[model samples]
Target: MLEEKKFFIHEDWVVVILAALIIALAVGGLILPVPEFNWSNASELFQTVLEPRNLGIIALQFTFVFIIAAIGALLNKRPLKGYLISFPIVYLITIAALILAGNSQVKAINLEAVIFSLGLGLIISNFFKLPEWLKSALSTEMFVKIGLVLLGTGIIFADILKAGSLGLIQALIVVITVWYFAYWLCKKLKIDDELTMMISSAVSICGVSAAIATSGAIKGDSKKLSYVISMVLITAIPMMIFMPLIAKYLGLSQEVTGAWLGGSIDTTGAVVASGSLVGEEALKISTIVKFSQNVLLGLAAFAISVFWTYTKHPNSKDPDSKPTIGVIWDRFPKFVLGFIAASLLFSFILDPATVSSVKSSLKNLQGLWFALAFTSIGLETNFADLFSKQSKKPFYAFLLAQTFNVVVTLAVALLLFN
Candidate 1:
């Protein structure tokens, strides 16, 4: 007899279910009185976990982990026993990293939880051997997609509008210019198309999320994805801490400095950290500029999907076959649609107070999911392959592109905000 298909539920359905659950929870939090979750004491994981107020938050996290692990077990055609055994291990490790990241000194320097989580996971995976069952449930992409969908709830269009036309103009200029320049530089460096696309997207857009979305669109290698993520995270820290200092040294106004940090820094968290280092007004401007760039993520992913599908398919037998709308749709990353929908629903449908309340509760959960995903990336990646000869070109190209991005964005910020 033929072996039964391992998974009853399709992967696409898992995406849909997870996205719906996150959106539903956000909405529910608005109507219900949900306890606020804070990461301020993340360094004291044990103490924080024991606190009565954090009990609900911990339960919520475990619920998500259990759900995803169960679904992943089904998809891999594995026994749920392994998943149950492994998820807590991964979670505990992630929690420890978060705790370290939450230390006052670490937070002051902008060492984000995601970075620590990924680093700790890498150390464990490299220095010690892990059980196969534990590795099986890592599910890096799945966790990331879910996190991105939840992240959508935080992006409000009203805030984008409030950012004003100058912010939009600055964002557009930085994104388009940096994107093509990075793409061309990667091409010149002789990196492959998929890797180049991912690097460019990460540099030009929202860093890890942009890279993940591009990888999903083009069906890129997980190793390459991990490499790109590593680069983004490693570079983001110094930039986050020093950008504001540099702006201050130059005597740039808070608004101009905020716009520069927002447009230049690859990660949103880093942007916020850098912006805050400047002042309240700088933080506000930086957030607006970053959000304006963030709003373009879905569109950029869609455009890249169409371009890659039509221009770069190596197996296409017919040289002249025109790509139809259906082909583009098929190649598109479905999670992006969910991401956009969540943003729109939260931004347009909910009243301001409800949105604010929902965001406060849901934001930390989103960070947790992303932390888990980055940890998974570390677990699944081999250090040797990540630092291979083939990876060098892309790394240098990314560095050059990011340098160009900083200079250009600073110029644009001055032109627009100064």
Candidate 2:
């Protein structure tokens, strides 16, 4: 029998480190004079990097990522030497991709950093066989979980409150409606339960993160997860670029357009990109709506887990035995709790000025974590597996569901935001 791997630390320790890092950064921002920076334009971002202060920021980022990668190496029981050597290369590639995506021309087309990083990694992985040691360090799930926890720091409960009942209602309607539609469609197309859940969650909530969360809850196939992720990413690009243009052509108000984009776009990054194309008000409203939807991820995962577990084991020897609170708690994604805690802490505990300062300083770090995760995803995913014959049904199911989402969300945005 293969020996089970041992780790110096449990996986949960990574979550603690992520939480501590966010809190430390937030507190540090309050005490330190952090430099103001922008990546709004590619040329400007590249120029900014040459500045001493920005260079220091970059070094700090590298140090933080190195520590995280080291921890990942330990958890996977891998040789630290190879991981240390390869991590910098991966990090640099992801950073370069981010810079490229931030360029004025790329930004105009709304090609996000996540897409660039994934594409770059996919090209390298497909064209050349990567070293086994390097593959060992590609901890996509860990990076994504850390990113999600850090992402919580940016979500302020006050913002959700400010968005009012309409935002919550719209999110509820879109998530529930889209999720069931996708699930039912997949079943009709004879897709497996695992793939159906993954696609449904990706369509209804946030994209990659939601798919990851649901897959964990259902213990779905990694290749299926990658397929759903690819579907979301590919569909998101066109939606991100064209949605704003369509809104403009229809003469929709910025708020309505923002809500529509937020509800329809699978990824938060894509929603923000699409909303930015519309206007400032659209960007703000889009973020609020997206957050409102994201807040449902934990709940959705838990619900699916219960449904999966009970349905699969319906004839349990003890028919009287039903899933308990323990089951629900176990099924819930802990990172979501961290995200919520971070959001609540930033919104309610911190003073406004400190919160603002912290948000500004730490925002890019979250993006970097997500970029790394996407790069890892691309590196691990084989294009052939993602587009296999078994995936055809899921592809059609996702396409149909997302089209329905777009139409329904647009109508709801008009009714609520307009």
Candidate 3:
């Protein structure tokens, strides 16, 4: 019986399998069409977004992902009955958020669907009492890892190579420098290691996405992850609006401004929106810089996993005790392997034509998974815990790190792009 129990699949392994299976289906041409949600006005919204055909597409998407969620629940040895009942409600809520995000006015401000998803979930979870079964069924980590694995397909190495050498250089310097800076600040502030890592990654890397990835890699708490994510999203808005004004005021060139904005801002959408406020040249350069930074996400996750397992694992308390390779491997997040594999397959193995055909469908699924994860995160998190007295130090550390990020990135951009 002990031996049999040993064979019970870990959630991480199940995520890898499920992600790979989804990728296989996408590559095999079982592509689902992305529904049109963009609308400028209420009338247009009704005519285009709420059209019967579009509604059907949305329903189909829900059905596909629901099946995938159920399969994941089954493989993880969780109770499927509760998940089956709760997932549809989650899906509906996420859809409402998606529609709001898809509105033209929301797009103008560069708000993401996940933000609304998080907000709605928070509203529901905070105001009402939830059942234990519903809470139990919220598989936030699994959903995040699967979305991240699917996110890999978009991180084509070929595109990264073609982006710009300078962009890659800036990304490397900024991520490493800002990460350590944030970490050191958190340490000085007496923040816990988990919050420190999540905050550092969110500030230095790519905001919500980076925080989510780091949380999954380290198996951090959802409440802490939610806190970091909230900080990222909230700070991003002001940064997005003000950075361009500051750049213009400094008499910076579009190239320098673009690089600065790209490196400093957390989210891709925010980066793009901020850059566009500068000029077309700025828009292009900023995107290249952001994309370059995004490509490093996989490598960072791997390094963090190795470092965390080697130094922070329960068995690694003794300084002289070296963790064996097998132990490290056992501790690694297998979904990261799936993430890298998906990237490689899309980058080198698949033909461009095939990639183009399925890219939209896969991207949609990826966003949906991320949205679902954030919703779960919001549901699982308590309002007071998310912003408790204990969070002040981490919050201060993040702001200080972000301020440093902005100044340093501007200097780098001036040096490299000016």
> What clash pairs does model 2 have?
none
Candidate with better TM-score, 2 vs 3: 3
Clashes (backbone N, CA, C under 3 Å), per candidate, total 2, 0, 0
Off by over 4 Å in 3: 1-6, 316-319
**Residue pairs with clashing backbones, model 3:** none
RMSD of each: 3.1, 3.8, 1.6
Model 1 TM-score on a 0 to 1 scale: 0.91
Full candidate order by TM-score, most accurate first: 3, 1, 2
The lDDT, on a scale of 0 to 1, for candidate 3 is 0.89
Residues 141-179, candidate 3: write the lDDT tens digits: 889889989988998888868866999999999999999
Candidate 2, residues 279-372: lDDT per residue as tens digits?
9999999988898887777677768888877766544687667767676555555666677777778889888988776775566767788888
- The models' CA-based lDDT, in order, is 0.82, 0.79, 0.89
Tell me the TM-score of each prediction against the true structure. 0.91, 0.87, 0.96
**Candidate 1 wrong stretches, greater than 4 Å:** 1-13, 29-60, 72-81
After superposing all C-alphas onto the true structure, candidate 3 shows an RMSD in angstroms of 1.6
Query: Distance (Å) between predicted and true CA of 272, model 3?
Result: 1.4
Per-residue lDDT of 264-355 in model 1, one digit per residue for the tens?
Answer: 89888898889888899999999999888888888899899998988865447875787777777777888888889889888888788777
